[model samples]
Target: MDDHTALIRATLDHIHQGVCIFNKENRLVGWNQQVANMLSLKLTQFRVGADFDFLFRRLQDELRIQSGTSPASVLAWVEDRGPRPPLRFEVRQRQGRVFDIFAQEMPDRGFVISFTDVTAERRAAAALRAANDLLEARVEARTAEIAVALADAERANASKSRFVAAASHDLLQPLSAAKLYCASLADDTLAPAQTEILSKALNALNSVEDIIGALMDISQLETGNAPVRVGAVDLGRVLRQLGDELHPAARAKGLDLRIRPSHALVQTDASYLRRILQNLIGNAIRYTRTGRVLVGTRTDGDALRIEVWDTGPGIPLAEHENIYKEFHRIDPAANTGNGLGLGLAIVERACALLDHPHGMHTRLGRGTCFHLTVPRAGLPPRDAALPAPEPGTDLAGLIVLLVEADSQTRRALSGLMERWGVEVLDVASGTEAAALLAEIDLVPDAMLIDAPVDDGHAGLALIARLRAQFGQVPCRMLTADCTPGLGADCVLMDVSLLLEPVDPAALAFFLASARVSG
Candidate 1:
């Protein structure tokens, strides 16, 4: 062979795929040893002048023509010189091996064919498909398990909420009775030691009541059972009300509770906003041993920032996030009161539900300030202020119709009201109260009814009936059931709501207002 031909043959021999060329006369012109090896042909049989038809026939007979074309048709297809795209196909040998074949027509009517061994590649692709299938199956099974577990957890949470509702109501009944009795006893003359003992007893009862209230609030917030009625709320009025309600407690602690007044109306759920601020201020008061707790508001670019500041041992940086967690105390040893540490938890959840952004700023020992941002809803009405009953106001000659199912609570409340110079017509049920009122033919100046009198329906019905009968008597509904919609119901019925165990100062203020209105 000449040098050029020898060089071309040497280059073809180095190629990984089998390479072969055929002329227009269908005779082989060039080929590599790989062509002979891939086709299972002897070197003598694969001569340079060999006919392409003979090699194709041999391959067809040996490999069983897996492409589903007969040898005659394939030979005819190869003999044709029509212009077309490159033909690519796969063939499997009888020995279970696979090969990829490529045939490209040259410009001179001849063709170049290549054979590539794809047996390992096919096996690997099959293995990969199987592995992917197995992985997808495992993922599907795990997803199903997670869905079931989530459903179970949701059911358990709902059950716990129901239990909390029932247990709180049951517990608060006697707690209210005990507090009322202690309050009544405080009015009587006693020695200094006896009075101190009585005060401590009342403090302990108050602690229990606070813990229960916190738990109930947390449960309502977590279970999404706290109703949110968003509207334009009088910020000044709410602040003033809270200040009036909490002022006594702060004074008792010897802490100055300063509430800065503002007539800015805010767009928010009034009930939730009130509860959130109540918890913040109450928490501040609880932790603060000395100094002052201040509540105020400021305008902040279409939003109102309501802040509660306290002069107590501030939260540590490490415990900042933990403060919102249930039952997590900053300094457990220093906390002497019976608190479950649920105040901030409730506040957090309530704020989240209201979509109001809340946060805190703190110093280690000086103090801490908790703030919430709410959207501004313009100014309140010019005459938004009503004269609030003054502190230490008396309810003497105020006839209060008290309808409570629990006998002890009824008796204790009656005694406490009587001590305050109010005439109390206390009864165990709405039926008894109505019957007693009918028999005496006397209209009470106000009505204080337990919300759960006959599964929370009778008390509401009794209020409606009495208002229809007596013409617009001021009514207050007391309840330990912190269920959703209770406040809305009270509002719709135009009655005040007092959550138990009721604060004595708040109850006294209500009675004093009733006396004034009467």
Candidate 2:
């Protein structure tokens, strides 16, 4: 062979793939040793004068026919003798070996074919497909498990909310009775030492009541049960009421409680807004030893910023984020107030429900200012403030109907009303109360019905019946249920709602007002 021909032959033999060449007459012109090895053919079979069709027939006999290709189809393709386009296909030998075959027609109407071992590539592809299927199956199983776990967690949370409500209702019944008994005793003349003991006892009871209330609030807010009624709320009136209520506690601590007057109307849930400010102002007054607690409102762009500023020991930087967590306290040793550390948690949740943004600013050793922004509504009505009943108002000569399920609470409350010179007709159920009133043929000046009276029917239903029977008498519904829609129901029925444990002062005010109106 010439130098160039020798070099070409050497290159073709060195290649990994089998190589073969054909001449115009369809006779073998060139060949590589790899072609013989890949096709399992003897080197002696590779003669220069060998026909391409004969070589292909020999290869077909040595290899298994591909799935969709028949011996007839192969014979037709070989006999056509026409120019063929480049073709590629995979085939397997009967001995379980895979090969890739390629054929390309030369310009002279002859064709060359090559073979390459592909057994390892096919095995690796199959293994990869199996691994992918396994991974997909595992992912699907895990996803199903997570879905079931999440459903279980949600059910547990709902159950927890129901349990808390039931337990609080049961607990508050006795607690209200205790508080009423204490109030009754306080009215009796006693020795100086006995009076002090009674005062401390009342304080202890009040602390317990506060803790229970905080727990109930936290439960409602956390479990998404606290109902929000957004409307135009008179901000000034709420602040004034809170100021009047908390003034005594502030004065007792020698702190100035300043509530700047504002007539701004805002869109929010009145009850929640009141509670948020109540907790913030109360917290300020509690933490502040001898400084002023200021509450006021200022106008932002389209919102009102209500702020509660206090001159007290500022919170540490590290404790800022933690203050909103349940039962988390800063300087617990120094906190002497009746707080369960749930105040801020309630504020945070309530604000989130209302979509109100609340934040705080503080400086160590100076004080802290907590503020919340609320969307402002139009001008408030001309008369926003209702006349508050005078403190220590008398309820004497008032015939009040008390429908309490618990006997202890009924007796205790009756004694308290009697001590206040009021006549109380106490019954354990709505049926008894109605029957007693009918027997006596007497119309009470006011009614105090425990919500969900002993028979498990709502007090509002009873109130409606009583009003229908005996003209619209001033009515109040005493309840331990803080569920949503209770307040709206009471409002629609024109009955006041006093949540248990009922404050003696609030109960007295309702009776005094009812007596006066009657």
Compute the lDDT of residue 333 as modeled in candidate 1. 80
Instruction: Give the top-scoring candidate (TM-score).
Output: 1
Summarize candidate 2's per-residue lDDT along 210-272 as a digit string, tens digits.
Answer: 788788788878777466788777777677556655766676688988888778888988777
Show model 1 residue runs off by greater than 4 Å. 1-7, 25-30, 41-79, 188-193, 219-229, 254-261, 288-292, 309-336, 359-369, 425-442, 453-472, 483-496
Quick one: RMSD of model 1? Answer: 4.1
Question: Cα lDDT of all candidates, in order?
Answer: 0.82, 0.81
Backbone clash tally for model 2?
A: 0
Which TM-score value belongs to model 1? 0.82
Which 10 residues in a row give candidate 1 its minimum summed lDDT? 483-492
lDDT of 1 by residue, 354-385 (tens): 89999999998999999999999966647444
Most accurate candidate by lDDT: 1
What are the runs in model 2 whose C-alpha is more than 4 Å off?
Answer: 1-5, 22-29, 45-85, 92-97, 220-274, 288-294, 310-319, 362-367, 377-383, 429-447, 453-457, 460-476, 484-497, 512-518
